[model samples]
Target chain A: MIPASFDYIAVKTVPEAVAELAKHGDESKLLAGGHSLIPLMKLRLSTPSFVVDIGRVKDLNYIRRTDGHIAFGALTTHHDIEFSDLVKEQLPLLASAASQIGDPQVRNRGTMGGAAAHADPSGDYPTCLLTLDAEFDVVGPNGRRVIKASDFFVGTFTSALQPDEVLTEIRVPAPPAGTRGTYLKFSRRSQDWAIVAVAAQATVKDRKFQEIRIGLTSMGGTPLRASAVEAALRGKSADADTIRKAAEKAAEGTDPPQDLNGSPDYRRHLATVLTRRALEQLTAGR
Target chain B: MRHRVAMTINGTQYEHEVEPRTLLVYYIREQAGLTGTHIGCDTSSCGACTVEMDGHSVKSCTVFAVQADGAQITTIEGLAVGSQLHPLQQAFWDEHGLQCGYCTPGMIMAAKQLLERNPKPTEQEIRLGIEGNLCRCTGYQNIVKAIETAARTMAAQAGKEVKAPAAVS
Candidate 1:
């Protein structure tokens, strides 16, 4: 499937990319790994007149530690994140999710920032980033600004990013010590999109849930926080019964879409089951 | 608009003026005239168009030809040196890894990467490694065996111990 003819602009630096976007305005689309955008373009779902290729921007491909966060350059591929020792140690939840995304070839070309900016409700990074409360640094014609994960995702296939802005870096705050996390994705196939997935990060102290955050994928138009479940579990005993009871609230505010993969009710049930499973696994030996 | 794209395919340099939307798979078959890489599914789901771009496996169909500027690409046609077949090709032939031979190039390319990353992979590892490449025939039993055989052959060529397939029943 060939995408519509568009003028291609390859930029070597962030400034150059920003300049091109400013020139083209909304008529341009930034190409990071091209995994998400190319497919949509081929299907004519998106037809940007100009494509700014930022895949070669060397400065925007890194994973480094900052003050209290692990900052990832927007161009860091899922393959890089899945195998990064820093990501594996600091953010196992993100690592696990990245490893499970698409397949080997897809992961080799898909980027973290691309996934987040695409804002697919079933995307793995957004769910994990939302649960981790990650922050994004974006550069535009005006200037640089930071957006929180909570506010970055506006809706399905939408983000808060302006047409002329490029996501430069993703900063995931280092979880407090003793925190354990897991991402449980229940897909029909290993490479398929999640039917309903759960991302959980928990910290237990004295057999009590000190800190618990849950993020649900494909449970709503956007990746949503299981706030009701988190609230129910916070400061509560980290027992199997308590966890199960709290997980029942996983779909409290979600507006899960129905398709051939499952119905809204089926997704709700999966959210609860997967949330419980994730919590149980995270708090197993705590 | 057309874009000037230059890349080294296999061991030869090829340059072409392609549309910005030209997929790498088509560019390889038409521009470079290497038809060994088959296109099973235009979508990224199928690995039939798999190729090694700069030492990593990627679905050529998903990658634009212009995006491969200055990249070093290895296609299935590049696997054989003159009349001698690559270890993967020989292994597939000996193990009957393919039936209709449509998915052979892609499966061999994917397996080449798997063996490069891991010289000796278990049955489960082999299965997981080639998960991207689907074969409707052979039930993947022989494909797994073929990869194991290639791994051993390659390892033995490097003077490493040819361990038996421990996970295969």
Candidate 2:
């Protein structure tokens, strides 16, 4: 399907991209790898007048450790994350999420920032990032500011980012020692998007749950952490009974929508099952 | 806007003016006239438009012609020498990997990427590598064999050793 005609401007610098977006407001959209936006444009869901291609801005494609956190340039491709030695070592949960994002071709072109900026509730990164307590570095005409993961996702396919702002970086706090986590997604096919996903990060000391973070994807209007379940599991011994009791609250307060993939009731059931499986895998040294 | 696109395809340089919206598959097939790069699904779902762009396999239909303006591309047509087919192409033919041949061009390109990355891939790795490229025929049994055969052939060729092709039973 041919996308609607639009002006194509390749910007070399962030300032140029910001200026173009600020001048055009809602009419302008920053183009990174175009995996998410182009598909939407082809479907006629997005018809911006100006597509400011910021892919050539080489400075925005980096993965670095800074300020006791890991900062990823929004332009970094999933391929980059899947292959990076640093990511594979220190951030295996994020790396595993990147590895499972899409088929090989989609992974080759899809960028992390593009996915995060699009803020699709069903996307894998948002749920994983929420569990990691990540922050997004937004650059706008006024200046730069950071938005926490909980506040970044406003609703389905929406974010707190203003029209004139571009998400420049994703900052994730370093995992605490003895931290182990896993992201479990259940899909009908290998390349199909997750029907339900659970990202669980846990710190176990003295065989007890020191800290637990549970994030749910495709559960509601946004990727959300299961605070109720976390609170239940906190300070409890890591065992089948405690894990099962905590995971029972996986979808206690969720308002999951019914779709062709599954019904809300089915998804609620899946959340419990997937959360239990994720916790089991993490506890088993997965 | 029209821009001069300079690219090297199959080690040959070509420069042409392409509309900003022209897709890379269109340029490869229409302008460069390499029809081997088929357009099965223009929406990038089918891997029939797969090609090696800048040493990595990508869906040409998903990338604009301008995005590849200064890149190197290798279509299925460039996978062989003057007369000899690439080992992958030969293995596919020998193993009857294709039925209708509609998805062969893409299957070969996707496998090329796999072999380039993992010269000796297991069956599971081969399946994972070409998972993006869909095939409606043969249920992927022969395609898996063809890739495994091609990997061995490629490894042998790299070591300058000639070996008889193994039969896939």
Summarize candidate 2's per-residue lDDT along B1-169 as a digit string, tens digits: 6778889999999889886666788899999988998888677687889999887788888887777877999999898998999999999999989999988999999998888777888999999999878887745999999999999888877896443322100
A-chain TM-score in candidate 1? 0.98
lDDT of 1: 0.91
Q: Which stretches of candidate 1 lie over 4 Å from their true place?
A: B161-169
Residue-level lDDT of model 2, residues A157-214, one tens digit each, is 9999999998899999877776887788888888878999998888888878888889
- On lDDT, the candidate that comes out on top is 1
Q: Please, what are the lDDT tens digits per residue for candidate 1 over residues B1-169? A: 7889999999899998999989999999999999999999788887999999998899999998989999999999898989999999999999989898888888999888778777788898888788888876755888889999998889989785654432110
* Model-by-model DockQ, in order: 0.48, 0.33
**Model 1 misses residue A38 by how many Å?**
0.8
**What is the per-candidate TM-score for chain B?**
0.93, 0.91
- The TM-score obtained by model 2 is 0.95
Q: Which parts of model 2 are misplaced by more than 4 Å?
A: B160-169
Query: Model 2, residue A47: what's the lDDT?
Result: 87
Pairs of residues clashing in candidate 2: none
